[model samples]
Target: MVIQKKVGFISVLFIISMHSWCQQQINLVDKFQNQKIKAVNRSITLYGDQRDAIELNAENSSGIGIIEDLEFEKGIIEIELLGENNPGKSFIGIAFNIQNNDTYEAVYFRPFNFVAEEQIRKEHMVQYIYHPEFTWRKLRSERTGIFEKGIRIPPDPEDWFKVSIHIKENNIEVYVNDLSEPSLIVDRLSSTKSKKIGVWSGYGSSGRFKNLIIK
Candidate 1:
């Protein structure tokens, strides 16, 4: 009986240790100025009153602030994003399974479309794209509703909102503001592989991101 109890305790300890090892968190606010982040075509600035967030500005084209030394193939990626209500601008989201500056899969949001009166515009609230091949333009023209969809509950475009992305194999699920239902779900256009992840901002857009947790 004593031997069995000792073995059971050891097994429990091993399970807890393995769980901790599998979970990883990136300290975005504390490590903003460090070498952990590599910017690509992005002008990064510290934002928020507490200065706990980082802003990405892209003038002419899309930009990404890639997190260095971390490669993720699947699991959960959660972050808080803030974008302006400026129509035709303000695109903010996350890019993962990245291969390079021009190759990766991304799910972005057009905050201005969140509460648009036009049904067509509202349906464009959230989008997914595999860059360099399946650009937003190509997807919108070719696939249309297959890649983008409207949010069930709209968030203020000018304020912060929590975004949770779940990636499992070829399936991707996105939840906004802790909603019970996902805002969007789409099969990844690219093959599953381990690569870097980044905070992405679209053309002529400026956005703030914080509380980035990867699990």
Candidate 2:
């Protein structure tokens, strides 16, 4: 019908737009720049946060704080981070293609749980999450082993360790300390595509991060 043809044309245009976006050259990783970000939590402040380094003070509250900027689709995102033992819920990582802090794909680490005596807690070390919809809770409940898995190699969970995340199309590979192999890999990104990039932390969790490079 006529309506069907119009819909098809619109879809084609959208696809073309996305293709152009993907090809657009951006060089944020070349230098550490103080870029602007839309924080998911207004209560959490980043007044002293820096481009080469960032320390978040959650003020003893729990919630996801994200940076809604970067508009990164695919490439490598690497950073060195140290999660504080106090305020103690360590869910630190990067949230990409962030529609918002509440809506995005994030691969975070639960350092406290990394070396827990219990296997269940150990299994919670590294995770892939889709906010507001499929959290680590829902992913554990329904998808089970698909979205989250244990880390075989444990770096000083509380100390600074480098993490490198490589994204290509719908696939994402997470590299912890060791870059030779991925600690976790996701076969699918979002149908919406990943555009935004930011360091994220759970509520009450404070962290120190540096050397963020994206190419």
Q: What TM-score goes with each of the models?
A: 0.90, 0.73
Q: Which ten residues in a row have the lowest lDDT in candidate 1?
A: 27-36
Please give, for residues 1-215, the per-residue lDDT of candidate 1 as tens digits: 99999999999999999988887877786667786788888878888788889988768888899998787888999999999889989999999988889898999999999879999998999999999899999999999898999999989988899999999887999999969999999998988664789999999988899988888
**Top-scoring candidate (TM-score):** 1
Provide the overall lDDT of each model, using Cα atoms, as 2-decimal numbers: 0.89, 0.68
Clashing pairs in 2: 61-204, 62-203, 63-203, 71-195, 72-195, 97-195, 97-196
The best candidate by lDDT is: 1
Estimate the Cα RMSD of every predicted model relative to the unseen true structure: 2.3, 10.5
Score residue 106 of candidate 1 by CA lDDT.
95
